[model samples]
Target: MTTTTETATHPLEILFQLQDLLLIARKKSEQKDRIPEHLQHVDAAFREISARRAERQERLKAAEARKKALEGEIADVAEKTKKYQGQLPSVKTNREYGALLNEIDGVKREVRAREDEILALEEQIATLKAEQAEVDATFPEEEARFEEQMAGWREEQAILAVDAERAAKRAAELRAGVDKKMLANFDRIAKARGGIAVVKVMMMASHTAACAGCNLRLRPQLLSDVRLSKEMVHCEGCRRILYWDHRADL
Candidate 1:
């Protein structure tokens, strides 16, 4: 069971409204799971397209890095081949000359292999760039379409904004009316207890009343006090103030 802040207009009543309003004012959007299906689809589609575009850009970068590394390898191999070929003229024997020729051939083959890799990377890079360009061309339209399709979500967001503003204004008024010490106590408890300081009593399975916050069985005397609603009644276990909410869902 929950106590709504807007229900009873006393200090407790003000607290109930304030608690609910505080949470409401904090919300900027509906939870993902709670978003309506149509809006979810629109949002998901936009994200998917965006992810695809991002993936393409990332792949292009990786391809460019690989290409650069291969080009460096080719340069190093070419330099080695030049040094080996230069040693040919200074060879003292046919054996040394043949060894130098083999060394040059080996380096040449290595360079060819790296050049082939560079070519492949260049091709892949071009493909990625084309795909990215496609995304760039189409993504704006997709974004516009998503925004158009999410008209309902946009409307809901506007409503939430309005409600949050109203809640904030009302909360300010409620805070002004509350005793400063009580308000301080409420803020302390709410912060310590995940933003819920005022709570309703729950009837347990055995038909005994319990603290909704802590689910601790309330003493008869405490429950009686809660029912009287004369002053703040704190739950023994949770230390959260308890209110007798007749509208509590049993």
Candidate 2:
């Protein structure tokens, strides 16, 4: 009772299935060959190291400022001591001479304290300089490594771009050969089915056949249509375009 329209072969159906396979392959290959996430970690590490270097430089500047301030204090104390010593020869009373000598001793004590502080700041500056040099030496190597990884990623992306373009062109050519109504139906199914618009029926060892897209059992009538391989058919359960896999024996 089946008319010719129901039994006629649809070549575009096979082309649709081939296009879907190509799309899946292209997507998977692009995903796998893309750059790994470690490149971002490298960039973060560089930023952290650069920040630490700036912090050390600021600390060194503060130390230098403290050292300079202490030097000025020491100079002022020395000048005060000299002035007090020169005034002691013109003093007529013992009280004035005693007070000037006391002032000179106090200034000398301050000068000694200031010199001790200067020495401490100098030691801190030296330590900071050594740490900065070590960081500087390591930074260049890290930056170079990141640059190399970025270059590799760019190259890989370029290759994937070419492959994707060729695949798209081939799919377009295949689509152009298909009837507009069939192509529209395929696209609608694909949009609803996560890029798996068509699938070949797969037979299991248990002698049960299933829709490869949804793994549902095929009905007796649907199975007959699939076995005939004359007309394009869809799985009633999953609504996916169905094709026979003669190479399933392989």
List where candidate 2 sits over 4 angstroms from the true fold.
1-13, 21-34, 43-145, 205-207, 246-250
TM-score of 2: 0.50
Question: TM-scores, in order shown?
Answer: 0.65, 0.50
Off by over 4 Å in 1: 1-14, 26-34, 133-135, 158-195, 200-220, 223-232, 236-239, 243-250
Clashes of each: 2, 0
Candidate 2 residue lDDT tens string, 33-146: 655686767667778877888899999999999998888878887888898899989999999988988998899889888888888889999999999889889878877877
TM-score (C-alpha, index-matched) for candidate 1: 0.65
The lDDT of each candidate is 0.82, 0.78
Report lDDT (Cα) of residue 229, candidate 1. 62
RMSD of 1: 7.2
Residue 9 lDDT (model 2): 38
lDDT of 1 by residue, 20-101 (tens): 9887776643332266775677677789888888888888999999888888888888889888877888899999888889
Clashing residue pairs in candidate 1, if any?
5-16, 5-17
